[model samples]
Each structure stands twice: as structure tokens, then as C-alpha cells.
Target: MVNSKFEFTNIKCYCPVDKFCHVEYCYLKSVNRSYKYFSARSNIHQNPITNFTVNLALLKRYNGYKPFLYNFTVDGCKFLGNSKAANPVSKYFFEFFAPYMNANHKCPYDHDLIIEKLPASSMDYRLSKLLPFPEGDYLFNITWLIIGIPHGNIQIYGSLS
Candidate 1:
């Protein structure tokens, strides 16, 4: 994919003065913790995906942690090709989310994003690998984390994991 045009130019998160903050730095302590355990587990010859799962969970928890800018964009795209500039909410989700969680890097409709409104307390879950271009060809299992967030935040998290 082409690089995302979306940019978050002036975020004021508390960073140590001497170093540049990389993406991993955004999740610093968790990233370090992930590294420590991952290194030990890898030494014991466990699959890398397990380590990844732990790290991803930590990253997910970052959602509950305070964000430097509650109002921000993360994905690299600014707008869907046919999206209206007048729609502020859509604009916010696409730009902030497309890269942060890496979903519908283009426009959701353009990418075939399948959306359904499930009941608040339902135990049923939906999983989709297609109707969304590149993601459409892949398979994913929906899980409790996907159901835990409010519907609005669910979309913010890209397709449910």
C-alpha cells in the first residue's frame, strides 16, 4: 500500500526530552514489558505469535489509558475518495483510525467494509474477511474484546479481531 497521507503533526504527549518518539515509544512501558517476557519466552522456544498476542493485548489496553490527544488521527489516509469533506465525524474516524489500528486505509465503502449493528448484550459475534478488498481475502475471528467496546469505538478499532 502507498504511504498514508494522514499525519498527526503536533501531539504533545509527555516524552523524554532527549529522544525522538517512535511508534513503539507511544507504548513504551508496555513495549518494554512485552520485550522482557517475549525475550524469555523466545529463549524457551515458544511461538512468536504468542508473544505477539501479549504485546497486542498490551497495546489494546493503551486504549483505556489516557491519550495525549483525545482528538487525534492515526491512520495515514485523510479521506475516502467519495467522502464528503462536510462530514466531520466520518472525517475524524477515518483519519484518526485508519492508521492507528490500520483499517479501511481508503474509504470503508470503497474497501467493502461490512457493517452490522448487533444488540448491546448479545452473545453472538460476527466475523468477516472480505467485502473489504485486501482484508476481504483474509479470515479473522471475532472475540470478546471486539464486543467489549462501545459500538462507536468498535469501528474505531478497525474490523473486530
Candidate 2:
């Protein structure tokens, strides 16, 4: 797809240095993780069109620990194509998320990514595979982190087995 234009604001950053403060760095890293794990498990190993699951532990063991990023755009072609954007609170299931994820690099694995965490209280989760574009018509905020697993409806995605 050809490139387009955009504009956005309301950003906050947390990086090792100001040089690494770019949101795209963190956002793209997260996407590449999902692509490597989820896209590989679903498309290559299990049923790509329906429910397929993989242990998050396996992903960590295989792909290295995931670097959780603040909610940001991973797939921004829509904005790049038509100048529109998506919301963080919207429902997203990365079913057909391969094309967008594989756009940058190849994801090779036998299973799909299905995270399993202790279902914590006051926390509901849905896997995020897409984020808004990082170009014009964009808004960004970054934050630092400590080691804690993300909270979401992870159980509903796949079984613990």
C-alpha cells in the first residue's frame, strides 16, 4: 500500500534515553512479538481460521520474553490508506492479523500465541495485534514498566491445556 498523511498528539514517553523515546520503537517491537508468536501458532500450527492455542510460556522460552508496550498502533495501514484511525478500547481479535503482521518479517513456528495468566480481579483482557499508525493524525504516550504479566480475557481465547 502507498503511504498517506496523518496528525496526532497527547503523548507521554518512557525510554532509556530521549533518542529511544520514539513510540514506534516500542509499538513495533510488541507487534513483532505477536506476529512471531500468535501468527505462527495460528497460521502454521493450529487452525488458522478458528480457535488455536499456545502457551505464553512457550513463546517466552522460544522468542525471548515479550516487551509489553503501552497501547499503541501495530497495524496502521488504514490510516496510511484512508486517513482514518482506530481506538484502543475497541474490540480486536487478530484472526486475520497475519497479513499485517507478516508485512515486515517472516513468522515461523508450529503453534499460535494464546496467553494464559492468573485471571486477576478487576482486569479483563483481549489480545492486541493492531495499533494506530505512528505518522500524522497520530497521538502517542509512552510509559516505563516493571515485570508484571498483562491482564485480559486470556482464558477465553484458549484452554489451559
Candidate 3:
């Protein structure tokens, strides 16, 4: 759920409903879902390669940092899931993939593979790469670990530095 305290621009998912489903649930169902393409809901004059910064936080309501995997497919990019924790160095792992993601499309594999420890750390070293413009727009899929608690925070940002 998005909080009212922050400002966010609402955008719709351009992909068909079947393709828009997050991959974590498929794992929960013990199924392998198909990966298809999607376009950004918002219009961009130029496809900006954003520096994606994903921040995973432990929900205050939970005992500790929760763990799981999330997955989704876009522009035929396939990101796999890895279990990890929330430590100082691990922030870069999330940043490595940040260049590929946006606010609407998150890693679908976040629910299945979760980190077991608090103050966890892991590194995903996806290099800075340009995403091909989709036939209509750009799309990419990501599979990453996330916490299990409902209240954990997620943040996305573009780096000017």
C-alpha cells in the first residue's frame, strides 16, 4: 500500500493482465508463469535509463527483516532471485539492478527467496546497460528478494550522481 505522506505520480500498467502478474505468487503456487512484454504507463519522450535504487527495510511490526523473492519479465530481460540480508554493502546489489527498473515494475521473485538474517547483505552486480526501446515502449523483468512482513518499506529513486 502506498502512503499518503509521499508524493507519487500514478501510472497504469500497459501490459496485458496475464503478463502483469508478479512472479512471486507463481512460485507460491508452485508454478512457472510465462514471461511477456510490457510498456511504461507513462509517456517518455526519450527512454531514460534510470539508475534504479531499491531499498528494502524490515517492517516495524515484524520481529526482524522478512525474506522472499519477486519476479517479472519486461523487454525480455530475465533477472533471477537470490536470498540476502539488509546490511550496508548490500545496498549496491539493489543499485546494480536499479538502472533497469521503474516504479511500476518490480522484481517478481521477491517473495519466494527471502533473507533469513537481520542487517543482511548481498551484491547483485548488473552493469549499466541500455534497454532497447520496446516495440511500443521499454520493458524489463526482475527477480529479487524482499521481506515477508506487510509493513516493510520500499523506495525507488533516480541517481543524479
Best model number under TM-score: 1
Segments in model 1 whose C-alpha atoms lie over 4 Å from true places = 1-29, 33-79, 84-86, 105-161
Models sorted by lDDT, best on top: 3, 2, 1
| Candidate 2 vs. true structure, TM-score | 0.17
If scored against the real structure, what TM-score would every candidate get?
0.20, 0.17, 0.18
Candidate 3, residues 1-161, lDDT tens digits: the string is 31111111111222122222322211111122322112222222222323223333211112432222323212211222332333423433445334334432333322222221111011101222221111111112222222321212222211111
Off by over 4 Å in 2: 1-85, 91-111, 122-161
Worst 10 residues of 3 by lDDT: 116-125
| Model 1 lDDT per residue over 1-161, tens place | 32211111111112121221111212111223212100000011111111000001111223452222123222223334444652564343233223323234343212212222212111111122211121211111111111132111111122122
Model 1 lDDT-worst window of ten:
36-45
How accurate locally is residue 99 in candidate 3, as Cα lDDT from 0 to 100?
Answer: 39
Give per-residue CA lDDT, model 2, range 67-146, as digits (tens): 32334333223322322244433213232232334322222223433222212110112221133222222111212221
